[model samples]
Target: MTINCLDLFAGSGGFTLGLKEAGIKTKAAIEIDRFAVETFRHNFPKVDMHHRDITSFNDKEIKSNFTGVDLIVGGPPCQGFSVAGPSQYGKLDDRNNLVLEYLRFVKVISPNMVIMENVKNFINGKLPSKDKVIDVVTNILDKLGYDIKIEVLYAPKFGVPQSRTRVFVIAIKRGCGLPFPEIHETHGPDKKNYITVGEAITDLPFISSSAGYDDSPDKLTYNEIELSTYQKMMRKDGKGIYNHISMKHTPRLIERFKHIPLGGSLLDVPLEHGQRARNGTDLDTKARFKMNNQRLDPSKISHCVTASFQSTFVHPVMNRNLTAREGARLQSFPDKFIFKGPRTLMSKSLLIRENREHEIGLSQYNQIGNSVPPLLAKAIGSAIVKSFKHKVNDTRRATHEFA
Candidate 1:
């Protein structure tokens, strides 16, 4: 029997992509953003998409959508729980409380297994200590008689090119007693090397920031490559890769990139160029150096890929920041998974363009930044499916003995 899943806060279906890869069928997904909904449909046309606010989601409606889901996978919105975003007290209306909505569904649907992902700050943040979150979550699951396991996983360790750290909680129905998912150590003394930025993007051709050329809407073009290994692997299939959103750079941003050396930051540029450098620590400054290239430190891996263009995500080799496609590649989204919607349509577009004056899809870029790497999602999906199957097996054995 096919393992089925109900995905919550399913942004662009990154979690769904992984679940599908791990052999679980996504029966339905709930998301609020119209852009994310469009992107999800571009990839998963058949998934039952509920574009309603997660807070308004109905448990009975969800339960009626599927008979018995083997797994539930999702992340509640993380702004309130995120240390990076504005840290509001856990208010009743705070988006962070959507975790309760997730719990409500768990109570109603009672899936055999549940998998959750969120920013690492969810565990380390001060407002809601990790313990508090776990206690509440575990209590709910415990009431339903399930054993839970939680961990903070780093994505690069799982073959994703970028360094993304997230808190993951996995639970299996008790009495079945399934073990937690094994960590796939792909890098270091124990295994092969962790995925690298160079390994992820060596295939695309180079495009200068000033160039006003556009490829056919169907066939996308890659602008840079450091090596052929990553490039060749990404292009293994002829269908061409997806999620290739490149932004146009302003004259000043382009000049700043030109002056900044490889692995150097905006601070590295001379003061003559109207920029300043940090004295000791990384404060929010345009003058700070951006670590654009992926360095080969076997002990430490790459930095987390974020959606903000102004952040320190510049190309290691190129003069400007890493484009949306480059960021997506680092996150291990397949080549065919294209993103929709223009970047400048969001509320923050004016501020972004005023500061940088770039004509790229800023909102869509942020979505990609906020998304869970689909490859990592697949790993979580696989683990959840395995745990669910183990529970079903135990159930069958108990029934047979009674018979």
Candidate 2:
């Protein structure tokens, strides 16, 4: 009665890790990013990793290989439907069509269950063809005899120390009589309080912006401090601290950080210190994004970590930006889950100017920010596992009675 899964668009195996934690076996994964694929292969060496685009495979090829998969999980590129994407394009962005590619695989695989994750805006997004994305997906699942349930899950409520929210579409095949999985919130007012940023990362050793390197053997050993419950869980199987290196900020940038208080953003900085311009021209005007360079309030959950998180979150107490490991901790990634690839990447403009777009790949920060929190995924996966076990037990009892 083991459940086998095929993970599509599996960036760095976040979903795979959660499924594994929930006692589900991820038989295979497909990812297009070379660095992410390498990370996935490194972490999940036994899984069949396909390092190519999902659209490259025809329906016949998918069916021939993934015919018996019990579950299919994916979070297709959300840039097109994300609120962070360019608003001018809105639903007309070409990347929004990737959902169709996701559906294509689902149609061919016809797994017992399907789970799709995306940014919160995905619930209201529409394709270029003037059809709502959710409506289109639901119609297809309905035609395929699936019972669909969609929910927007909040990360903090699920024990993640980040205030991120995403939409999940869960579909179970008809005739199984298995109701939708019940994913209960474990960290809220009625339950345990939400894990705080301090609880999630305060245990890691401190390092200056100039300390640590990418993929270097140099690692800061953990201190013998009293560990929090969240810290104990994170360090359960971790060998040592890795990817805890901070970004080297300019002296001026460090000075700017001095003006911002805890939970304060760039708006707190004086205009003389190169604050962001308002209306693209009024540099003297006090206007800044709440997400940009905001010092973390250690007492509460963190703001959403986006793919550009390399420059998004300032450290809670330090006058530097968060290291890749700190962001990973906020996202509920265990300490043992080593992120592979460059620590950071050049800006998109620089890459384009230097004609290095072809060499583009996900950096450690990008991979961390792009991932679903493993703890949240585990909660959802646990519910699915519970329902599956229940179905299996009922089937066994019925067979015994018949015989």
Scored by TM-score, the top model is 2
What is the per-residue lDDT of model 2 for residues 1-403, given as tens digits with 9 covering 90 to 100?
A: 7899999999998899988999999998999998899889989999999999898999788987776799999898888788778534543787778898998888888888999999998887878786889999999999998999999999999889988999999999999757789998888764249888898888776777767655553447775789889999998887778788888888988998888899898877887775545454535544566667899998988889889988888888888899998899998889889998888888777898999997688999999999989998899889999989888888899999999
* Position 284, candidate 1: lDDT: 44
TM-score of 1: 0.81
My TM-score estimates for the predictions, one after another, are: 0.81, 0.95
Stretches of candidate 1 off by over 4 Å are 88-93, 126-131, 176-179, 188-192, 210-233, 236-238, 241-245, 274-301, 309-311, 344-362, 389-403
lDDT of 1 by residue, 293-378 (tens): 22222233447766554245556555555555666677777766677766435445565767854443335677777788887887
lDDT of each: 0.66, 0.86
Worst 10 residues of 1 by lDDT: 292-301
The positional error of residue 104 in candidate 1, measured at the CA in angstroms, is 1.0
Best by lDDT: 2
Cα-based RMSD of candidate 1: 5.3
How does candidate 2 fare on TM-score?
Answer: 0.95
